[model samples]
Target: LFGKKYIVGGNFEYETELGNIKDGKVLKLQGLSQKHRIETTKMENMLSYNIFASLNLTEDFSLLGSYTSTKSKEYDSDSLTIGGKYKFNSVGDVVNTYFDNLSGNKNDRWRGTVNILLEAEDDSDRTYFDMDGNPYPGDYAASTLYVPKLTMSLNDLKSKWSYYFEGYYKDNEMFQGLKTNEAEQHATRVHLEARWNDTFSRGRYGINIAYRNETSEKPQNYGKKGFREVKRGVHQIRLTPNFIYNLGNGFALNGSFTNIYEYNYIGDKEGQGDFIMENQGGIDYSGLMPRAFMRLNLFREDTWHDHNNATERKRLTQIRPTFRYFFGNGAYTQLEARFPIYNGGYSNETRTQIIKSENYETRYGIKYIQPLAPGLTGTIGVTLLTIKAKNKATG
Candidate 1:
């Protein structure tokens, strides 16, 4: 019963930028506007506090609680966290529960100040207030979030394999209006992860799985009249397994796989299911100077709106290989190439007059770096690309 303290901190930031930026890589429509290029100013202020206390109830039990608050213009929130652990001395097992309540504001905007020039109206006679006489919304789009989690983990590392499991539930409510623009969401998640390594192989591997179910209700535009409430539900599951191996001699291989499955339903309609899988692999030859690196990536996805209909599947495979050489003069040269293949089609049950399509692409590039002066450097590069396409029935 000796630890109790309170800490306070805050900060302020301001930024200004002038002139517009032009880059060809960016689309014209998404480029910055010319009018606002004159000057733009941003200001932010934040304040926070931390309060913690611990009490020993008995020789076998203890209590801990903490409160934290953060206030800012762009992001604002406050949270209360309290957790405790109970130990079963006879069985050497422990159970823990942690609870948190976080509430905050979102999307703060100032919307007043529009000049309306009416006929024969002077500056003093014109109305200068915002359209609704209010600079911001009444509620400021405030939201409350709650998450309670339970975790069971092994504290002792006597075994080569260790594992932990965590489960949590979340509820978030945002008040827009009572029925017009209000929003509420609820979700539950379970996560499990494990890791194992062998000293003989000098390799390590890990696996993780997560499952979540979420439902949300929010306001939406109903036709041309106004806003109405809508409900949506989602179910998602993901699994990931990865590992790395060292074959020695400055060579190593690493690979991982992730699979995601999701089902979405809206109102009373039949839900649709989506499945996607990604695989990534890489090989590094640090055995050589200026080293050689190569990577392969594969992605596939399948979507089924209804059980009676055929599913659509798409696949893509990519390979990237590069070689680089470094000079003692602070210069380097690199050669790179990319090969990718794309294939898409409908299931046989759903196939009609259309045929599946396949596309192949190959690219090659060479780049060189040289020291032009004491403090100046230059780069030269060239790239070439080719593409080909065909269909099931086409030669």
Candidate 2:
């Protein structure tokens, strides 16, 4: 005897912007010279809300819930969230005596979830860097955020097998003058699975295990003054046995093999010591290391139809390729390059570079679009970046 359902939704948004700039070394007689110019304009607004619910405490017991709220007063933010879920069922064994199947059901299952979040901000007219170092454009400044979460799952246990677990927590705050910034974070995850149907020949197989843990704190004008803190962990094991032979002409073959382990911890002690005398001219503090990677995927599908219009129109395609190689004990290898440009959709131009002893780095981009007719579209983009520092160590 049970039944219930409900849902609600909301949304509203608006944004505007304008800008102009000119100053090429004071216009040294260029085909077009605007001497020196600058213009700017902006406006913004946003609102959001959401709610949902479900319940059927019988014929297998069940319950669910959800909630979300958001508001953006021109960048001064706000946020919220709520969540819930529960389910239980099992049968076939006479003597199962209710109570959600003696608290252990077959075709079996158990689930749980919880969530909470809050945020706040006040920019204070902006412009900062005081305490005598210069640049003091003020409006005060304020910020806040907090989050919490939890999850649990166990499905089809007796008939085969499955398990999952998750956890999370966070807190952040910021304020200008007398300087005050704070941070905290925590994480946990676990999973397990096992399956072997088709008894002996027809085919189906599986085995998997995973684990992760994380911790962090040290934010408030960052590093140099935040008395840093960080910790990390990861472990994984996977073995898959898969097979399918329908042979009706649509061929198939699948494979899987994974083994991974990782660990990291960094508390920037003088930028992790001696990356050129503790980042001499500055930047490039390699701390926290331990890495590994191995991933692969392969898939194929085909279909076509036009045999006398039997209401059949079929066309299917799929192609996937991936490869990764990295090993333990602080491995290092990386390359990045970027170039960008786009207008309206928003992007003007952007470039980035990082040559860590030539491990690798490359990037490129360009974008610009603004066509309000025949397919309406708008875009703008711009970006540029480079890194490799530590040069100025003279006793």
Candidate 3:
């Protein structure tokens, strides 16, 4: 057995803007005046990095990993992951009393298994042109992804079934000024489930199914009449069903449902004539969405004559309530609002963007949490966002 653990964190953000541009549009110079201004300044910077790792090889095995890197002068991103697990018996050494076993069947009937996993990721970028202040290059891009996974659990063919499976593959590349594009993609998934119990009204039930597929190859742009190609495809299907009910004073109720489907391939002799895959003629689009959620809970406990009169019972309290609803059709909506002020000791967040134009956009924010001692904690927040666009016709 071997073990290792480490963590480090970092973050920095800065943004500044002062503006005026009358026929080169990108404006939001807040209530502009001062004779229609003509002087501008803008600056931005961001950086981040994170890494984590873990390993334990006995008492039911274990292994885990993570990585992240990011930078900005323009843009860069990275990611990675690894996994492991194993154990066939030892069954958590049979617990000491939770309503006295309540049927988890004591110990050792197949308690662990899941042995291989591999992951990968890549992101690419290049774009520059700041002129007189330096930096120049125009356009370039890249993308990559790979995944491998496997799992096992059938508990020696026992009657209350379970199963799982997953698969993935993806590749992509692009170049702007001389036109170059490459693409490859693949995916697979499988899952099976079963459960049944009823000793006079203690119930549980389940059912699930899933499938997916995707394909792509379309990118090319090296203007002045030369190079243009585009091609794409996608397909998907999914279904799920579930239920649980155990109300003996510590209430319980649950439910589930999901469905999806999509397919598309668009034109210029079906080789995406670049300028973002010009479909100016042939088109295919489809959409469907459904979601629902509900929750409720309450509990409290104290017994055994208050622990034989040594009297100490004050820990077991819970409360949960939730609700959600949704509907769709190429839909859109947004709203925003924010305001903030706090006394000294470094705290500032000023944000504002209220229901601005074209379709509907709104945003709102206000947050403050401060306690500089006794476990030290400090935070301040203010946000405002607005976006709305829909109007097109230029020939």
Better of 2 and 3 by TM-score: 3
Worst 10 residues of 1 by lDDT: 116-125
CA shift of 320, model 3, Å? 63
Q: Model 1: how large is the Cα RMSD against the reference?
A: 16.2
List the candidates' TM-scores in order: 0.46, 0.23, 0.24
- Which is the leading candidate under TM-score? 1
Name the regions of candidate 2 deviating beyond 4 angstroms.
1-83, 88-147, 157-160, 173-208, 213-215, 219-226, 231-262, 265-395
Tens digits of per-residue lDDT for model 2 on 296-371?
2332211212222322211111222222223332232332233221210111111222211111112333334444
lDDT of 1 by residue, 201-285 (tens): 7577766666666665544433234445556676778777887787787777777888888787655434777777777777756
**Residue lDDT tens for model 3, 346-393:** 111112211122223344644444545554444455555454343222
User: Candidate 3, after superposition: displacement of residue 226 in Å?
Assistant: 8.9
Worst 10 residues of 3 by lDDT: 275-284
Question: What lDDT does model 2 reach?
Answer: 0.34
